[model samples]
Target: MTRLTATAENQSLCTLSRDGSACSTAKYHEGAIAALAQARRALTAAEPGADPDDPIRAVRARWVGQAGAGTTGAAWRAYLEGGRDGLDILLAPAGTSTGPAAGTPPSATGPTAAGERAPGPASRVLVGSAAAGRLGGGRWPRRRVTATAVLTPALFAVLVAAGGGFPAAAPWTVLVALVAVAAAATLATYLPGPGKGRRPALGCSPCAAMAAMTVLAAAWFLQAAPHQPSMAAAALAAVGFGLLQRLTQTDASCAS
Candidate 1:
């Protein structure tokens, strides 16, 4: 009877252990299913045509709200349909496997498995093409012209001062010309529609070169005139010429 009772107790313990293991497995499976279902629902609501299996769509869908539970359909749609590319979406970590859920405190060090750290928000790979495309290839060209426009007048001012011909009137005249040229250059760069053509008037290269020469000429003319004010006036003309030249060059480059 003692042996039989001991055997029965052992059987009961084994049964309990088996039941506990089954419950644990069932809970894990349920969690996975729930996560996957949530991901699918998010994709369907946001992008009508997006595949649930698509990693980009999946990540974007997950990002719509805190705890992966976006309130508005529009929010989900925007996230999924936004300019990010497929590769960007794919590189993000699984939403269920990482990050703080909505209303939950952010993970101190994110999801950890022993010593391995899951990718954090900053570490996730982005869709490069979407970002690149939005920036546009024309930015460099536009920036170059802008730099030239700003620098050319300053260069002329320095040259005039160094040449021992700093006329009082020159500063005001140069200021006015700078304002006008900057305005025109800005218009040429940003005004919509196809350009009006690559004609010299719009291109302004000759105008820029001429302006440089005019400044030097004006200085010489004032020196010859033997009048200090006249010299100042000549310096001013040089400044105007330089500004005009820059404007024209920018316009030309933009058109081309």
Candidate 2:
């Protein structure tokens, strides 16, 4: 994908988070460099058909020209210092262009100066458009993450109740193992993100596998009286089952 397209995708993902700053540094840097390359190439290309007066194109061309061949410095200044949102603005399709370089006032005879500024409702329209695009693309993984987070804690609570209560004297080794399992599950949830496609109907194999793994691990390691499962055992199993679901769902969505 073009850097602009990839950067747009990355920014779409960032919207899922509250802080509005979730994409990794590596991805941001990569996108910025690629975007600069795009601008540079467009500027250098010998094309008779390309418009010379397109403001967005002009701004990008100028920025890339000023940056020259030093992509590292350009990437840092154009993206990191100004913020990834600025890149998002730049990536905004040509006519909707706004970005770090967009701060320069529009020319006196340009669209903005001709009393064509969009009203407040136009901003809402853009937001809705963005939301629809994300949904149609199946790029949002919020459902998977939310479900796992909620279910994991609930499963633990249920298991604890069924087991009567956690023994105050549980071994440190068992606690360590439980923590490790939880960490593993959490890690699994986020590694492979969702892809573009319709979400398939929920399947059972992953859920079954997660449940089995959790139960077996608990059964093998946790010492319990008679037939009753230990609270710690239940907690360990729940963590594995709950967290792993996110990873499984992500894989399944991608497969579909």
Candidate 3:
């Protein structure tokens, strides 16, 4: 009885092995059929004028099937290399005619390989002129805007200090100040958010300095106020605000 049970177990193992092999073979053949169908569709789409008997077309079809089967790293590299060789065949002079033939190269009167349509002398000159105009027009304004943004504020500040009073420099100073503020805002918007468990607030030394100067300028503007603060008081307020901004950033980072 023990020997008979052992024999039965051996037969069951053989049957399972045979079934697994058959399933694997069926899957492989299904994949091959799908790949072949895809290759036929792609070859027809890529070159409508190509000959059915063309050797290059046959090579490309084979590559399309293999690629569809999901070739991997090294296999993919080899497939691409083979595909390029196939393209070369199709593009070679022997595969094409310049005259009245199915694979004929386009005439000089037609589009070039660069896809430029046949152009008359006048049209060519117009295209060149338009391209040049676009190039110069776009670049010059950008350079001018950048130079003005950087230089205008510094120069205005110097002029105001040299004048020894805020009223005399108020107009130009205000204009430059507003421009600087807008630029700072734009830059802050694009900056990356602080890391997780870090600060959400943005801070810049230059911005802090600008805020301090603005406070001073505002005090000067309000010199005629019925109750005006002293210069020392104004300076202290500026320093307090700067410190507050820094502390707030630290607290936010800790919370995160």
Candidate 4:
């Protein structure tokens, strides 16, 4: 590689628009990446109310940073003056500086070579929600909703089955109700949309399930005769409800 002349380095390094007439530069920076960063900063400042922290902004920052490296003075100046579209004119030249030299491990490659990028907030929330449906769990939080939905119906069924089964209503009716409730809860889980933080009770499956179960248990207690066995059963149900509710409200998505 030919060393950049002192005159060439000075012209490339100087980003001030007020600098002398534009000219081609052989050397832009000691590191190619650094040169692009300086150029991008100047261009970003020209935008109205631009925020550096914006996710897409951050992505573009990294992209222009590396892609701009080793750029000729003429290309850098054009990009600064005309924005991203201006870079199109210099793609062929910039493409050469990207990626790793031959024989470099994939991990050792720079962002340009690897072609991987972190998602912005909007994108992260969207992708996390989509992934939650197919995969078990991750950054997405749905443990509370899932738990309440599962535990309530489950406990109700166990208690009913333990007490010689439902006498007043056909066993199939009880089973059908459980299935319907479960289906509703499942639909609600995906319907109200994905959440980033703590979720509410209205649309959450586990929360709704727990509420329904508690009501069903209380009704059972009311119908039973005032005997020790009946009271003991109600007490057990109450205790389970409390414990399950507490568990459901926690970050239990990972347990799945």
Using TM-score as the measure, the top candidate is 2
- lDDT leaderboard ranking: 2, 4, 1, 3
Q: Which stretches of model 2 miss by more than 4 angstroms?
A: 1-72, 81-188, 196-256
- State every prediction's TM-score relative to the real structure: 0.23, 0.26, 0.17, 0.20
Count of clashing pairs, candidate 4? 3
Scored by Cα lDDT, where does model 1 land? Answer: 0.36
Q: Estimate candidate 3's alpha-carbon lDDT, on a 0 to 1 scale.
A: 0.34
Go through the candidates in order and give the C-alpha RMSD of each one to the true structure.
26.7, 16.6, 26.3, 21.2
In candidate 2, what are the lDDT values of residues 146-171, reduced to their tens digit? 64465555544433434444553446
lDDT of 3 by residue, 1-256 (tens): 1121132232222232322433222222222222223333444454645543353345456655555445554323332433333233233443232221222212211112332233332333333334333322222234334644665466445434533436534444454354343333332322233231233234333353443354345335334331223432343344345433432322111110
Deviation (Å) of 149 in candidate 2: 7.1
lDDT of 4 by residue, 87-197 (tens): 221232322444433322222222232333334423433433333222322223355366546656765565455444555345434443443344333333332224333
Q: Point out where model 4 deviates above 4 Å.
A: 1-113, 137-159, 168-256
Worst ten-residue run, lDDT, model 4? 247-256
Error of 1 at 199 (Å): 17
**lDDT tens digits, residue span 1-256, model 1:** 1121232232222232322433222222222222333333344355544333464455445443332344233322222222122222233455524322232112111112223434333333222322222222223355446655775566445434544544446554454344334333433332221232333333323443454455555546544543344445555556555554443233222111
Cα deviation at 254, candidate 3, in Å, is 52
